[model samples]
Target: MRLDPQKTEFDLGYLGKQSQISVYWNLSSPQLIEQSIINKEANLSPTGALLVSTGEFTGRSPNDKYIVNYQEPSDQEIDWGKVNQPFLPEKFDQLLVKVLSHLESKNIYVQDVLVGSNPQHQRRVRLLTEYAWSALFARDLLIPGIDMYADGPDFTIIQAPTFCADPQIDGTLTKTFIVIDFVKRIVLIGNTQYAGEIKKAVFTIMNRLLPGENVLPMHCSANIGMQGDTALFFGLSGTGKTTLSSDPDRFLIGDDEHGWAQDGVFNFEGGCYAKTINLKKDLEPIIWDASQSFGSVLENVTFDEDTRLLDFTDSSVTENTRAAYALDNVARRVKSGMGGHPDHIFFLSADAFGVLPPIASLSPNQAAYYFLSGYTAKLAGTERGLGCEPQATFSACFGAPFMPLNPVKYANMLREKIFDHHSSVWLVNTGWTGGPYGIGSRIKLPYTRAIISAAIKGILEEAPSEYEPFFGLKIPGIIPGVPSKMLNPVKNWESPDKYAEMAEKLKAKFRKNIDQYKGEIDSELLTLL
Candidate 1:
């Protein structure tokens, strides 16, 4: 179905119904593509994808994101800190009035979508954006609204990219802000043109709201084998969640954002938003093909002046350059976007320190520990203002920015699910090896794929295993396709002494980061430190 401008309706409380605003409701993808070009908000790439530039901000402004501290009894459960920074409800109300006032007489695009794949625990979302391109991004990423005439949305997002916040008056850190009010079930975004802010605002909300219902929200990728064995790939940005899960032999459930229920895992998104910086056709053919499709949206990606051919290798625009396309754009995607309870889970990390093993199996206790630690390296250009040098990062559950509850809340859910489903968990390092970054080269993609293939084929289950004391991970002594030297990271290092030195340093850092959780979590699991 397509939008009917004549029949468009809205409430005056949030939006002035009598104003000269042109509200386009529920437009189809084709309509949005055509409108975006006509409005000159975006251009058409040579590959037929919609191309748009998110000026100034190409990545999320995490520090600017605030959660309104309404002091509701339920909000007392929220673990508030720098990541889940608090905002005054009075400030939020003032900002809402200003945002709604700014949109009074301007053209806006509205969309209704669903956030969760499982109908049993889905959220009805209503999105209102100032740009047609942003509306298309939301429509392509989230499930289309099922009941067009349904009642009020469970959550509403009002985004005005052009409206700048007054730091002095708004009590904000910058001219841009992303504020989420759980009590009001509303999110307000201003001054940032980044479309990811819209998608992630909802994700952060889900990460906060879902755990209370016993549904574990995750920042991971999932795929299923022909026999219905589901596997999850967990990692931070640049850790290869999108790259590894696009396996030709498997059916992809989703590339990011999923929920684990009592029955199984379900994707939260309807499409894949993949990083496209320095992308090579031979390296990641699945993502390359999807980026060239008709209905895709390319953000901050540049093309040749005459040929219009994308220069994926170029980082002049930003390394966070991205491509958004429907899940069906990929050849081997699961149609239902639902999978059996994950039988296997893989935690991926690009260990810049080069001390962790390339691949290691984990016991239930060890899995809980590492899962809570959620260790990885943040590559340069992955986020706004990040330098070229890789920096060590420890985000709980691999997604600290989105997690509002205590880390133990998520860790407990993962422990319960793994035991209930009898799932096997493994830690895979897709990062540098032999030595730290600059000294050692990154792990080859082919080798990483082979390791994952063996794990999925059950090759590692019965293989000879060796335990590493520092991280407490069980290393598989031998695998059919992988090199034996690569099995243990320390073996390939130039100096065994230096390797041991670095390993001990990382273990110390892990302890320091999780010390705050000691009183709240299982003390036995912390012994893995």
Candidate 2:
């Protein structure tokens, strides 16, 4: 298949088709790599492969390999269960059935909740809760929504499909959740809800998978509709994933979570979950204003019902206090809510230790590490908040919770997509500067947002004379319009001694955490610290 280095031919190209998936492992031909192993005192046919996207080509070779050779399953056909224990618990089926009934019975409660709520909040939660439950039942009922693969690994994925735009409703979910039991060589699609629409999407797409052209399931937020190709920003929650990507210059696609189809990137959450702690007007002025309205969900916040004054610093509700608002809340949102191929990708991380540079160019390995690390600091809001103090938190790929179970598995998929799709990846720190965590304030959201804008526009590609190497990125000739002193974390400390103390303190924390997972990581990768 002809590949565009720049994500330009979106909506109308081989990549846009449903058969084109981001594979996680390399493939020999149309069939996946498999092997046999002994388990439970019996020999079984274990899968030695993971899934990946097949790039445009007549035959598979270098450009289209992502499936990883790992342990295969003993089952003859696709049984998602044979892979491992279900993420659910004993009798989870019964428990879930009860919850579904409760939701239906309390449907009136949801409607009542809507009475005092802004229409935006109502719609956002409705979609999230609906999809969550739909996938749950769809999986149980063996419906089209939670189907499995046709030819590779056995697992389920969250997929939203496209349908003829509904003239009545603003937007609607076309494709539901789907499971691809590649081991069975079958794609089980979920279709309980939106049957007419979902069928329109899956059937139209599935029949088109060519020998090498494919669509590997991916879990990342992506958007298109900017000036040219849609630019994608990949990072975990606190890495400014939402803050940095809401560019005013381009049409805003979805935020938070997305399902990447061969055609374009679509959002999972119909809304945004922005950090509300220490939120101010200058940075995210629009989102900032969204805090007090009827639509937002104030997490651990204190407010006056009569006066309408809000203390953004307060966290009385819950640590995960968030402002959940629909993407359409901002007028600049795209209608289809998906973007074309991306031209750039910026991975955000909040490095509290201040040991690494502010920015760095990522080698594919470093990109995988950082992405797996999902680097960021815990903040005042969010369930894991440890107060406003920033601290280094490295998750396997990008601090995403679902990592490690399939760290190498997911990384291979994402890496292949970026490269074959010709997407660029950059590592950026949004944590501390002069002092780590408590000693320093977060890299201002407004300033960080500006830097990201500059970077995405290709301004930082040339590597300038007056650039500072933070980690991998060259902080370009100090981003104008922001305080120059703030750009250099080293100088921002209250005093030299304070800076030294913070660095040592954070270093100790890093060592403690790294040691816990020492066995799993190779010393070579660990030596970078």
lDDT by residue (tens digit), candidate 2, 443-481 = 666677667666676766763524333233334446545
Name the runs in model 1 displaced over 4 angstroms.
1-7, 14-20
Tens digit per residue, CA lDDT, model 1, 1-529:
7553442756645332344445888888888887888889988887678989999998888899999997888888888988888999999989988898898766788889988988887898999888888888998888889765356888899999999999999989999999999878889999999999988998998898888778999999999999999999999988999999999889999998999998899999998899999888898899999977987899989887677778887889788899988887899999888898998899999999999998998889888888899999987766677887889999899988888888889999999999999999999999999899999889999899999999989998889988877776789999877789988888989898999999999999898888878788878866657
TM-score, cand. 1: 0.96
Overall lDDT per candidate, in order of appearance: 0.88, 0.41
List RMSD in Å for every model shown: 2.1, 18.4
Q: Candidate 1 at 347: error in angstroms?
A: 0.6
- Candidate 2 ranges with C-alpha deviation above 4 Å: 1-90, 94-226, 289-301, 307-313, 384-388, 403-405, 463-477, 482-529
